[model samples]
Target: TQLLEQSPQFLSIQEGENLTVYCNSSSVFSSLQWYRQEPGEGPVLLVTVVTGGEVKKLKRLTFQFGDARKDSSLHITAAQPGDTGLYLCAWEGYNKLIFGAGTRLAVHP
Candidate 1:
């Protein structure tokens, strides 16, 4: 089984503060994906970095994959209350997907 380690299992920040979440693994995957899940809703795919050292931006959020392809990070330029949610990092495993325990983020005004 692939094991992914996520940092800062819980995060609380004020609006407009910049924050980052990280995921690391000893195994390498073809791609690294980031998702955000809210109460009662399924996780939504925010972005995927397919190549090593790749970076993708979604509005104020930036996603980056490590050069070695075994880690990834999500950075928010300015956290917002709307951004409060469970952030998860995932990788393909067989025909399914394996996700980290996830980082619970709460951005308050």
Candidate 2:
């Protein structure tokens, strides 16, 4: 089974604090996608890193794909209350998606 494992099932931090979430797997994926979701809303794609050793940044958020394509990481700098949400990682371009357990972040002001 191609299962993605995420660390820190839940995190609570003060605003302006930085945090990192990780997604690891034994199986290699062609591409990895990161999404953030709020209550009652569908997940919004944060970033998609396809190439190994690729790094992409969106403002304060940075995403990295492992060279082996078996892991990914998301780092948020100076997190705010607006950044509090569920972060999910998934393998894309497959008929079925393999999603990580998810990391719930709560940033308090």
Candidate 3:
């Protein structure tokens, strides 16, 4: 089982800017997932990357898994204020999910 660690515990940016966040682990994972959470709400799954070197795009957001399956990244283009929230990365481990320390993003309009 891998222990995930996310970078840039907090970020504040202006609208229309771009940013990237990362999640890394020493152990390999079968899959990795990204999620977004708003205050007072449960996290909402964004994307899941399974195969190594795979990339997935959702509107202005992009997700990628490292070739070794030990790291992942999330990129946002032209970020909007609505994008403000907590971003999390999780991987399946021992029949449960091991989540990284989340990144809190605040996009100012």
Candidate 4:
């Protein structure tokens, strides 16, 4: 069985703060995707990093895939109130998906 474990299931931060969330697993995955979801809507794809040690940045958000492809991390710099939402990390392969427990971020302005 494959499972993804996420740290700090809930985070509350003041606006303009920095935070980092982590996803870890023992099994390797073909692809890892990060998504941000708002209330009553599906998760929006933030980024996908396939190569190990590869980092992708979108504005104040940065994502990294583990060298073994079994883990990933997301870092937000100077977060804003708009960043308050649920962040999820998912592993996809062979028409199957494994999702993390999900992290709920609250950015207070």
Candidate 5:
């Protein structure tokens, strides 16, 4: 069963624009993580929001965990072309990672 759902599975935007993608689940999670993957590359951990209502930032990206830990959001401010990639919301599972359907973002210069 799919435990998570991501919205706007595809997004195309101009550089400098801000955007946000979401990950949601009906069941609460102990922790949630966000990963980004570029073409021909493995997904890399961006940020992990472990606590409810917790927020973490990495340069222009911001990750937030819902108070109930049932959802999460990733916001990018002034997004750049370098940010173009597949964004996956996931959770650590038995030393592996279970991912979302993923949000593919393309930022044009």
Candidate 6:
């Protein structure tokens, strides 16, 4: 099974601020994904990075995968209160998916 470690377990910021979070692992993964979740709901996939060093942007959000394929990061620009939620990283391993502990974000307006 692939193991993921997420940094800065929690974060709080004002709207319009920018922030970044990270997910890392010792084992290489074929693909990595980012997700956002709201309270009492399931996580929503934001982006998936497969090629090493690949970068994908969704609106004000950006995702990058490590050249070694063992790490990833997410950056959000001009945060909004609507961005408040749980962010997670997941990877496929041994025919299953393993998730990180997750980062909880609170953006106050």
lDDT of each: 0.92, 0.91, 0.94, 0.90, 0.94, 0.94
lDDT pick, better of 4 and 6: 6
- Cα lDDT of model 3 by residue, 1-109, tens digit: 3388898899999999999999999988889999999999999999999999999999999999999999999999999999999999998768887789899999999
Q: Score candidate 1 by TM-score against the native.
A: 0.96
Name the TM-score of candidate 4: 0.94
Instruction: Report how far off residue 54 is in candidate 5 (Å).
Output: 0.3
lDDT of 5 by residue, 1-109 (tens): 6788998899999999999999999989899989999999999988889999999989999999999999999999999999999999998878987899999999999
Q: In terms of TM-score, how similar is model 2 to the real structure? A: 0.94
TM per candidate comes to 0.96, 0.94, 0.96, 0.94, 0.96, 0.95
Q: What lDDT tens digits, residue by residue, belong to model 2 across residues 1-109?
A: 4388998899999999999999999988889999999978988988889999999999999999999998999999999999989999988754866678899999999
Query: 11, model 6: CA deviation in Å?
Result: 0.2
> Candidate 1 — which residues are off by over 4 angstroms?
none
Cα shift from native, residue 44, model 4 (Å):
0.8
Give candidate 5's TM-score. Answer: 0.96
Candidate 3 stretches greater than 4 Å from native:
none
Per model, state how many residue pairs clash: 0, 0, 0, 0, 0, 0
Q: Summarize candidate 6's per-residue lDDT along 1-109 as a digit string, tens digits.
A: 4389997899999999999999999988899999999999999999889999999999999999999999999999999999999999999768877899999999999
Instruction: List runs of model 5 lying over 4 Å from the truth.
Output: none
Each candidate's root-mean-square deviation in Å? 1.2, 1.3, 1.6, 1.3, 0.9, 1.5
lDDT, candidate 4, equals 0.90
lDDT of predicted model 3: 0.94
Model 4 stretches with alpha carbons more than 4 Å out: none
Please say which candidate is ahead in TM-score: 5 or 6: 5
State residue 54's C-alpha deviation in candidate 2, in Å.
0.5
Please give the lDDT score at residue 52 for candidate 5: 98
Error at 38, model 3, angstroms:
0.6
Off by over 4 Å in 2: none
